[model samples]
Target: MTGRTGLEAVRIQHVLPYDPRQPGGVQTHTYALSRALSDVGHDSTIFAPSRPLRVSLGGTRADLALHPLDALALRRFLRLPHDLLHIQEPLLPAVGPLALLHPSPVPTVVTLHSAEVVAHRFYRWTAPLTRRLMRRADALICASPISHQTAVPAISYEPRIIYPCLDLAAFSAVTRNPEPNTILFVGRDEPRKGLTLLLRAIRQLPQAKLVIAGPVRHSTRQLADGRTTFLGPIPHEEIPLLMKSATCAAFPASGGEALGLVLIESMAAGVPLVASDIPGYRIATNNGDAALLSPPNDPDALAQNLLRLLDDAQLRERLANRGREAANRFDSHVIARQHLDLYQSLVPA
Candidate 1:
């Protein structure tokens, strides 16, 4: 019912800029869904950072630009008729003003992507605010069951689980030739991502090569084993190829109480996964289907799991096959439809 309306009939407001140069799961998901919502014939407006890139996404007319909520000039734009307004993230640099604009006459939906307050120190200031904003929105969305379970207890209403999506077509460039021996980790080189433990795990398997493809700051240098290669933030378009080149993906994820998009992205590229045994990973994999799970934060356990997957080709194949199926659920188009349903539920077409 959400999308079953005319263009001017349903004005869905989305807040988030589409910056291709900056690669991140939230950026990808926000832009992809905003574009899809337009394709389904629903009119929408995008409010985001004050300074937006001059370029436009491939096929969506989101009227992209910065709306800096606090700006005096943008106050009039905020009053425009909108049936639904979707806020992507609840942390600062994003939700700061969006939260203030909440309880608007129009229905609002806020997504709790990460428990950054616990993950990073800078975000500690946002934890209480995040809890407050969660109660303010008419609807809430979570990328994983674990995320919802961890984040929603503080809010007045239960947050619905609507997994973040991936546009599979974006990764069609990857050539899936079946060489399941290498391991890839596509995340920033933060301490919480468990980079040190991954290095120790790689050390356990001498033959296995590891490629960590993300921005590696000084913290990354601390864990730099001469053998590991940091490709320095590859473009999202090339992520599939990078994953395809490897036998599987590795994520010693320890930062946030949320799901890792890289794991699903790797699976979509037909690459098996080797992830931490956290609640988020367990909910994402449904228990070791798309990846080999090891005890969380334990390099030795991760090493054993890596060694086991590397040595057993048949088991690796099984995981890959199962992972492919689970990955399908996160396809952008399918997930977009689910969001449409949620919006309609709140607006009541």
Candidate 2:
């Protein structure tokens, strides 16, 4: 199990059921984990949908050929020399059950990234299936306390809490922007993500501008006041500079995040945060020590918090410095070592 250099270099196979063209926290987390494993002298390969990707967000890419549950695919995966099969966001109906049945021979670890799958209107029918899958996992990894709470009732075993890892070195390389007054928001425009609420809050502040990164699904009336700028689908490498240049970062997601990677990235860049007081964010920030909390779904509270951070330079600096320190806990090397330890525990002594 140990390499010649006295290090554990186990091979890991990460299974992702989601599309690569649509980038989100889960995609970012998978890619970061792969890179982190490599840094630790371990090998990681991703099994994702077989599609022509429009954009390349480079990690170790391999194809699952959209048949993750097929008998041939299952056998193929089970036969691999990989020590562990890590199923990211294992709530998908197709992939979750595969761990329970044919591939039961392999030691498997399942990471549950969101609680939404249990409550989504379309996925409600799959509740029983999801619970069974959760119980079948050899070792379960919850991305945050909220995610752990959601998985606890469904499974008989205790789930280990591992915060998603971040590439802090990349963010540290970027120089912090001087005289930053721009509030940064990164994520798709969705009801659950609170994009509308963010725009409404922007209307209340005349002295601040909000930089909306990522794709927007809903069209909005022209708020040509020059207070908000939409930069669609920003490159992943450029995100550190964007966070570094931010006066403060805002993520007002109302609910359903296992762990907010954007919040972690902002914290890593030493940028102050104004996030919704949801369980996911609350657990990540250690009960609001790392960031300011505004009540969810209330545009006025969001606006007030934004104004408070924008108007007070001393408050922003204090929160930013604390956030940077807190972000160290989620660094790539630290998280990778924790995961390697977990993988070691699952194997025979």
TM-score of each: 0.82, 0.86
**What lDDT is obtained when candidate 1 is compared to the true structure?**
0.69
For each candidate in the order shown, give its overall lDDT on alpha carbons. Answer: 0.69, 0.74
What are the per-residue Cα lDDT tens digits for candidate 1 across 264-324?
A: 7777677777888787777678676678888888888888888888788788778877887
lDDT of 2 by residue, 1-349 (tens): 4543257677788877656555666677777888888865777887666542333111212223245345356557657777778888776444445644654555789887664534343334555666666666788888877776655545556788888887878776657783456899988666678888888888888888888888775464253357778888888788887886789889999887777788888888888999999888886676789999999999999999999999899999899888888878888778877888888788654
Quote the RMSD, in angstroms, for model 1.
5.9
C-alpha positional error of residue 160 in candidate 2 after TM-score superposition, expressed in Å = 1.5
**Backbone-clash count (model 2):** 0
Best by TM-score: 2
User: Model 2, which residues run further than 4 Å from truth?
Assistant: 1-5, 52-77, 117-128, 178-180, 221-224
